[model samples]
Target: MARMTDPTNALRLFQHAFECGQIPVERGRIDPTLMFACDEPKGRTRFNYMRAEGRTLSALVMFVHSDMIEGHPCFNIGYAVAETFRGKGLAKSTLVAGLNEFTNGLNGACIPVIHIEAVIAPENFVSQQVATVIFDSTPVTITDRESGLPALHYMRRINLPMRRL
Candidate 1:
């Protein structure tokens, strides 16, 4: 379960998942965007990890740096688990693992506080439920980000003590 930063490994992992048809097409289509996003010259970082067993990728999670509410440092997590591994909570496990790695790796260098935020479409009840379970009573809100449509914002503090780098 190593977090992959090498472009080659990332691309290979993505291609394998796509070829298997185990990933939702809509979400899997972001592979190209992720490639571009991670290659940007800016300081923003995108961390990706693959769950593997004997050289085969079973699942992956991508954490992209983003602002939660203009001033808050947060990570937007996107994940996909292989069809053969969906119901066993791999998504949740991967998420937690990514969070821990991100917090430890970036806590002192990035913003002073670490928060995880998920912006889910209002009608995506399953995503909302997942966030609720992961965040455990953290504040949730509905926001309209100039799209004229409401979206759900779920937030959780990572409890990392942060200091300016």
Candidate 2:
């Protein structure tokens, strides 16, 4: 698992996906190098390999590149699942794992992440559909005045430090 974080490994997988046209890199998006360069001080970036049946289904990234919101950091969940594994619930479930880590202590108490975001393009219907199920509320369209991008913004929040009656 530790080796997956290696820059070379990430580059290999990223290159494969890029060559297959599964991701948009030339359109000013992501570069494989970014996966290795996610460091501290400003924000955090992490790229995890999604494995199924001991085989890699996707390379998912959950990055807290932005500062915290209401004391909770906002990390964006981005993934590039292999084309062959598309239409299956792998991506949807992968998203659930991220949301769960924030809500529940699925990843343990040390990393009590609570808020996450997923910004999707208007035309990406597959992701739009997944976002609908992942978030409790409907996806919000960010207008030019409201935000920088015109993508659909989806967020999940869980108030931590629960009280007992």
Candidate 3:
């Protein structure tokens, strides 16, 4: 349940994941300069799930604010699981946890009508399935934002459950 505020740490995790075969090379390396672009006051947040020893990264989830969805305030979601932890459903669960944290942080103060968006490579069927299960939305074909490749987009509205005050 560690939050990664430093771009370097997050990039390290990403590189590790890539080296361990979690991320395919075709996705291309993330530009160092852009890593902190979303680290603004109200732009992006990253969640890191580590193994029990707290040394190995099990999964990573990030939500970045985006205006690509038209009318709906959206946070584009991205995530990855370590190779050793893959196929165990770690990615989906971690993403759920990340979303809960993000929504809860709103604190009902100015609850914006927002939605979560997952842009996945069309060839990566596994992630597409995960996003469908979590978001319950049919994916629409679109060009990948970063790669300029074909992608599938999944989205669903999010709300902060009212607390019993």
Candidate 4:
């Protein structure tokens, strides 16, 4: 798993992925620079998993701390799989691995629970299916705060068990 910590490199990779149709455009424009923004509570964490070490990017999972639900941290989860890697369960597996690392970090920080939110385009059935399968929650139609477009919001609260780090 590759973690994009540099803004310039991250933006470049994301742009290349977009141009090659590896990333979906219907989710609305994304600002990868926000990954480095520290103004928001908990900020943002992104994990870019490559097919090979320092090689081709296969999928990316990003979680942005967007809100607090019932006094617990809430993050918006987003993911994309490379065009050639789609329909192969890559996205689901990548998300699982990425979320594991993310939650491990949270657990180390003493954050035991969090609310995970998924804001997906209404017509993006694949993402909706992934979210439903992973979260096992029904979505509610809501206007996306970032894109100002109608989206299906799926929320699930997760409890993090402590693990030896």
Ranking by lDDT: 4, 3, 1, 2
lDDT of 1 by residue, 1-165 (tens): 322222335546565755675544221122221211132226767666556543355666677777765567677665666666667876667666655555665657746666676666667665556566567765455664535456766777766667654
Q: List candidate 3 segments past 4 Å from native.
A: 1-53, 68-72, 161-165
Q: What is the C-alpha lDDT of each candidate?
A: 0.57, 0.52, 0.59, 0.62
Q: For residues 6-67, write the lDDT of model 2, one tens digit per residue.
A: 12344356556655756432211222222222334343555343333322334343444444
Q: Name the Cα RMSD for model 2.
A: 10.9
Worst 10 residues of 2 by lDDT: 26-35
Clashing pairs counted in every model: 0, 0, 0, 0
Clashing pairs in 1: none
lDDT against true structure, model 4 = 0.62
lDDT per residue (tens digit) for residues 26-131 in model 3: 2112221111112433534533322211335566666777764556567777777666778988777766665665565555656556778877776677777768
Best by lDDT: 4
Q: Is candidate 1 or candidate 3 better by lDDT?
A: 3
Q: Give the C-alpha miss distance for residue 102 in model 4, angstroms.
A: 1.4
> Candidate 3: which pairs clash?
none
What is the Cα-based lDDT of residue 22 in candidate 3? 64
Query: Which of 3 and 4 is the better model by TM-score?
Result: 4
**Candidate 1's error at 62, in angstroms?**
1.9
Name the runs in model 2 displaced over 4 angstroms.
Answer: 1-43, 47-49, 59-65, 101-113, 143-149, 161-165
TM-score of each: 0.59, 0.58, 0.66, 0.68
